[model samples]
Target: MQKLHKLLRMGDLAAFVGIVDDGGFAEAARRRGMSASTLSRSVTRLEEQLKVTLLRRTTRSIEITSEGAAVLAEAREILNRSETLKEIATSGQAPAGPLRVNAPVPFVLHVLAPRLAEFHANYPAIQLSIDMTDTLVDLIGSHADVAIRLGRLQDSEMLHRPIGRTAWKLVAAPDYLDRKGWPEALADLARLEQVRFAAPDHINTLRFIGMADPLEIPASVTANNGEAVRQLVLRGLGVARFSDFMIADDIRAGRLVELFSGQLDAEPLEISALYLTRVSGLRRLGVFLDWLDAIQVG
Candidate 1:
């Protein structure tokens, strides 16, 4: 409205967005084919108009102020909507420039992070910006090109393509299993050591194939994150369960052992690659989704 116009007047929204997204006036200017001083002035004008500081200046890094972070998210949303409008007006065209993606932390760390080199090598023109978190992201609100979602999905405007699936892999480091021994049966958990995160719902107990009841396993140590749990297992702490996606590499490398040799069922998890529209897919988004679909784990 009037205040928004006042806040963003004169300077293009793209300038401020470029500065925030690239993390500095210099990088933004470099990318936009403009001088750093120009982008600096653009940001300064924006701050003056908005009456708030957006960034903390330093030689090493430019940190976003709290207000700046909030505004940055909004600015990305605005830019995204503007892009969508332009695409609709012209018909969806060839994709270029940055392609923002959001995915769970574990997926990013284990699956996406390791293979990023291949992605870049294949599609060097598409700049990949990744947001790694377990939380679900609103595609339009976050201005993300795509999102990798796991488990049951709710009805939404976004189109989801089934990308991959993960099943439970009860894993332990070779040394740990050798020393502490593996949980031979579901009932053996009362005496075996286990590592788990504090996620009450996921690790409250272990569910097995053809088991009517969930078995509550006592944990030797509880960490706060999936990576932590994975690390503890690698460090020979205890036998713990992981989604095959999270422990695939380790299991492949013989760093960890999948416990259920012939006892468990492979109930793979349904993972989807989500995007806003299907009628006219962005070329880069389609390319990335195909690349993602080929990722092997469990």
Candidate 2:
């Protein structure tokens, strides 16, 4: 029983599921980062231990036997229950694992960075690795422990906790507004020079509160970097739409002024802390989520 338990690691079960999911040894091997022969050997070893043929292989395809199908279902259930048990067991212990996290560049700099010292002081045993980028990462494939995401999520498999909210604001340097004059209505936006952020191609079609319908703003300048946009706005070049958190300090310091404060829609973007359901219940992740929720940033 001890030997049998030693052989049944999660990686082996994952490989088995991969093979069954991909419908062939080669595809499963690719997904699992192993060669087809290696995956076949592992499966063969597993079958030998159980004294049962799990797969019927042909030149063109491979199929799970009735027994194999039953085993697969049981394996999945066992893995789920095992993970749950591990989470519960570790919840009361000090967090002492490597945690890989991802978030947008602006959010990391403005919101998270300021609070890292406190988190580190509280949980010195946990190691943190953060990737700051605008691109969404595949949490499972990337092995990310956690991610901070804005807006609605299309993937339903991830467990999400709402952390906070931020409103999008049209902002410009006080000096720039002094020269160009503030626009009275949405129609005036077309006449003014604007800086736009790097967004999906379809974003241009969506209408903001002031606009009657979708209207494309003249991209007098376009930047993939959020910091560059903020700098340009600070230099009195043009008005840019930015999340409130990004320009909060500037607004407070009188470096930038909010445009159309009352007339704009003031849509609040929902910020969420997301992780795979499998990873969400881990001790380190749970603590971080609680910490994130406790933080109050403007």
> Candidate 1, residues 1-298: lDDT per residue as tens digits?
2245445843556787777667678877886798988888878887887788888889767888988877776675665556656556644444456788988789889888889999898878778998876666687545577888877689655688888778777778988767766666667766667887776356435667788776666678988777888898899878777777888778889998887654555456778888874425356777787787787544
Residue 142, model 1, lDDT: 58
In candidate 2 the C-alpha lDDT for residue 199 amounts to: 72
Candidate 2 Cα lDDT to native: 0.76
List the global CA lDDT of all models: 0.74, 0.76
Residue ranges of candidate 2 with Cα displaced over 4 Å: 1-5, 8-92, 182-191, 201-211, 214-217, 278-280
Candidate 2 per-residue C-alpha lDDT over 1-298 given as tens digits, one digit per residue, 9 for 90 to 100: 3244455766666667678877789887775678999888878877887778889999889989987887787666666566667767877778767687899888998899988999999999889999888877776544566888877778766788888888777778888767877767767766667776667443223256655766556666777778777888899878877778999989999999887775555457788888865545567777888899889654
Cα lDDT over the full model 1: 0.74
User: How many residue pairs clash in all the candidates, one count each?
Assistant: 0, 0
The TM-scores of all predictions, comma-separated, are: 0.69, 0.69
